[model samples]
Target chain A: MFATLACVAAMYLTPLVWMISTSLKPEAQATDGSLRLLPVPASSVVERARANYYGEEAAGGAWKPGVWTDPSVDFPRFMRNTLVVCALSVTGMVISSAVVAYGFSRVRWRGRGLVFGVMLATMMIPFAVLMGPLYVIFGRLGLIGTLAPLWLPAWFGGAFNIFLLRQFYMQVPRELDEAARMDGCGHWGTFWRVIVPMSRPALAVVALYHFMFVWNDFLAPMVFLTHRDDFTLALGLQMYQSKAGNTPWNLLMAASTLVVAPVLLLFVLAQRQLVSGLSAGSVKE
Target chain B: MTREGRENLAGWVWVSPWVIGFGVFMLLPMAMSLYYSFTEYPMLEGPVWVGAENYARMLGDGTFWKTLWNTAWYGAVVIPLATALSLVIAGMLTSKVRAGGLFQAAVFIPTLVPLVASAMIWMWLFNGRHGLVNRALGLVGVDGPVWLERAGWAACALVIIALWGVGQQVMIYCAALREVPESLYEAADLDGMGPVRRFVSVTLPMISPVILFNVITLTIGTLQVFALPLALFQNSKGGPGQVGYFYTMYMFDKAFADGEMGYASALAWVQLVLVLGLTWLMFKVSGRVVHTRG
Candidate 1:
């Protein structure tokens, strides 16, 4: 049983290991078809790593490599663009979704049940159905080719986040809110003083999930952002791969590693919350 | 105002962002898309009404049918394989294994990789000449075909990539498995049932509802697969024989690349109907099989 489990784990992880291994090698070693997992001649490891990332010309003051040195496919710029979008969208999504969730969970009013039901149903409407008209709408608003199209809609509450937050808020005792009200707190005041402070972990889950979503999103950026300057990392990686004809495998892998490392780091840090949150959200509701 | 009226106003005020967002982003677009499907609109010009032409044209478009078939075939193969594989992995994790958390983390980490990065990683892994996959196969004296350059093999390569992301479902299954009653297992053991028989009778039925839920989600997800194939092929043109083309990719190409907004709107409507229909059908069919607790 131990041997079987080890093999299953290896089967799942080898591709990622190979990706990192490929990224560190020079172009010749990467495509040599040899079975070595490391760059040949360990003495040249640092030089090869420098060349793969910072470009050989910059690292050695010599001839240029291909796509890695191209200024337009700037990795740092793409990272900045992706970070900007993630920050704006994640903050907006968390705040708005929490407010909407508060209404659904804490406040009892006419038509609340029906409105909540409508919010849940909206989750089933696939993005494919929305991309067309959304593009036209953004075009008319003169927001196409800009980052506005990517982060603007997130200012509104999303269905899944609202549902998750609502589920969390429902567990907070109504007595707390009533006590705050007894102290002359309004609904807004009670929400901030009582509910928000208690739901930190759930809020973190929503923020992390939305952050990952914006980071990983490709189709929206691909459709809306026409200029290369506004491309997110996901789009920039594709642009690098396709635009760099006969792209060196090592540098491509390096770019991929750069794109994947942050998400992996985030996952490692919050593994418990992310795993539990994902399973709980799906299975319970 | 009455107390009830005051509560109602406050509730609406709190939820106004979503309410306005729902109308503008979802309802307005859906209504516009439905209207656009019946017209010939190419963004730069005003829409010209053309009754049923785009939908009628779709029936005769070979690429439309081809992509539809490709997407359907992908969903059919991927949904079942991913479901079973995840269930087996979840089963293994639940059986008192040492270092189980380490194993679970290893399985779950791949799903966190961005899709574009995942595509690049798989493209390198599936490379015909120097790919790790082919090197491993060569060790067994088996020759592997050029995956992305071939027709049938491209689809198989895609299925393999889809299987790699089944860890999310596995985690869900693990949670559901822990919720199963130990008394039922003891009862099965008292009846002299073996491990396999006990699992089939006890474990399977208890977790059937979660399975149904996961399968439906997978169906919706797999049928709309776009990024992996698009990145794998490195273009919307698709791989050899258009085998890598999918329904949404085609819709995207028509709308954005070819400027056929009306036709793409029609395709989008068809996709929405098909997804809704498949979801409804799954729920209807699984009514007897999914054992939900009261």
Candidate 2:
């Protein structure tokens, strides 16, 4: 059992380890016909300035490779664009979903159940069906070739997040709503005074989930954002792969590592919370 | 106004944003797409009503049929393998092992890496001559096929990548596996069931509902797989001979590359029906097998 588990663990982690390993290898060694995880130490420490890339070489410098200098793929711009989209989309999703969830869980209303059901039903409607019409709609709004189409719809409540938040909200005692109302709080007032403070963990889950979603989303950004300047990391990586030059496996791996690092770091730090929250989304009571 | 009336009004106010957005985004587009499916609405031009022509054209469209077959074939192969793999892995994780949480995290970390990045990583790993996969196979003294270049191997490569991201399902299954009562396992032991029989009789039935749910959802997800294949087969749209051409990929190509919006809308509608219909079918079929606690 121990041996089998170890084998599985190695299988799972190999691609990731290879990704990091390949990223650190120089162009020559990266493409060299071997599956070595670590770069071999060069025999000589002398600076081979003339033969080296960029015409500048210190001791052992030629062995080290950096993805930053890739002339074709602008990693910084991709990172910035992706960060902007993530920031806007995550904030929008958290706020909108929470607000809408308040309506579903905190209040008793005539059509609330029916409308909420509609929202949940729409969750089953795949985004593929909406792609064409949405493209047309965004094009009509003159939002094509911009980041607006990527992040704007998030301001509208996503059905899944709204459902998640509503489930969280329902657990908050109804008496809190009543007490807040007794203290001259309206719906907004009660939500601000009572629910938001207590629902911090739930809100964090929603935010983190949406953050990862926006960070990782490809098809939407691919369909909507056209220009090189607006390319998110996912699309930028695709563009990098599709570029006409000889594939720089090292730089490509570096680009991939850069794309994956932030989320992987967050997951490592918050594995407990993320695993619970993610499984909670799927596993029923 | 009565308190109930006031509450109703407030509810509307609070949910107004979602309501409006749902209308504009979901309802409006769905209605418009249904119309577009039956029309000649290219992006640059207005719709011209062409009753059932776009849907009818799918009958003769070889690519449409091929893509649908590829998608169905991919889903049929992937869903079961992935589910079983996750179930087994989750079962292993549930054993009284040291550092189970760390192992779980290791297994799941791949899922957090964006699909595009994962695809790129796999593309390199599936490279014909120098990929780690082929090299490992070579070490075993078996010749490795040019995975990305050949039709069958290209599909196999895609499925392998899909299986790697089964971490999410594994996590769900792990949670479910943990929830199965220890009492049940003890009871199975009392009945003198062997390990395999114990698993089949006790553990399997206990988590059958989760299995069913995962299968249905996996089916839905498999049908809509786009990004990984797109990124993996960047030059080919789909890989050699469009072997990786999936339903959504076809829809994307038709709508964007080919500028055949009306036909793509038809494809989209079919995809929606296929997903919903298959989900419904799974529920109906699995009703006999899925054990729901009364």
Kept native contacts, as fractions per model, are 0.74, 0.75
Residue lDDT tens for model 1, B1-294: 998899999999999999998998889999989999999999788789999999999989999999999999999899999999999999999888999989988888888889999999999999999888998899999898998889888888999999999988989999999889889999999999999999898999999999998998899887788898999899856798999899999999999888888999999999999988999999999998888888
Off by over 4 Å in 2: A42-66
lDDT of each: 0.89, 0.85
Model 1 regions more than 4 Å off: A57-60, A63-69
Worst lDDT 10-window in candidate 1 chain A: A58-67
Predicted structure with the largest lDDT when compared to the true one: 1
Q: What does candidate 1 score on TM?
A: 0.97
The backbone clash count of each candidate, in order, is: 0, 0
Least well predicted 10-residue stretch by lDDT in candidate 1 chain B: B235-244
User: Candidates' TM-scores?
Assistant: 0.97, 0.94
Ten contiguous residues minimizing lDDT sum, candidate 2 chain B: B230-239
Q: How closely does chain A match the true chain A in each prediction, as TM-score? A: 0.95, 0.89
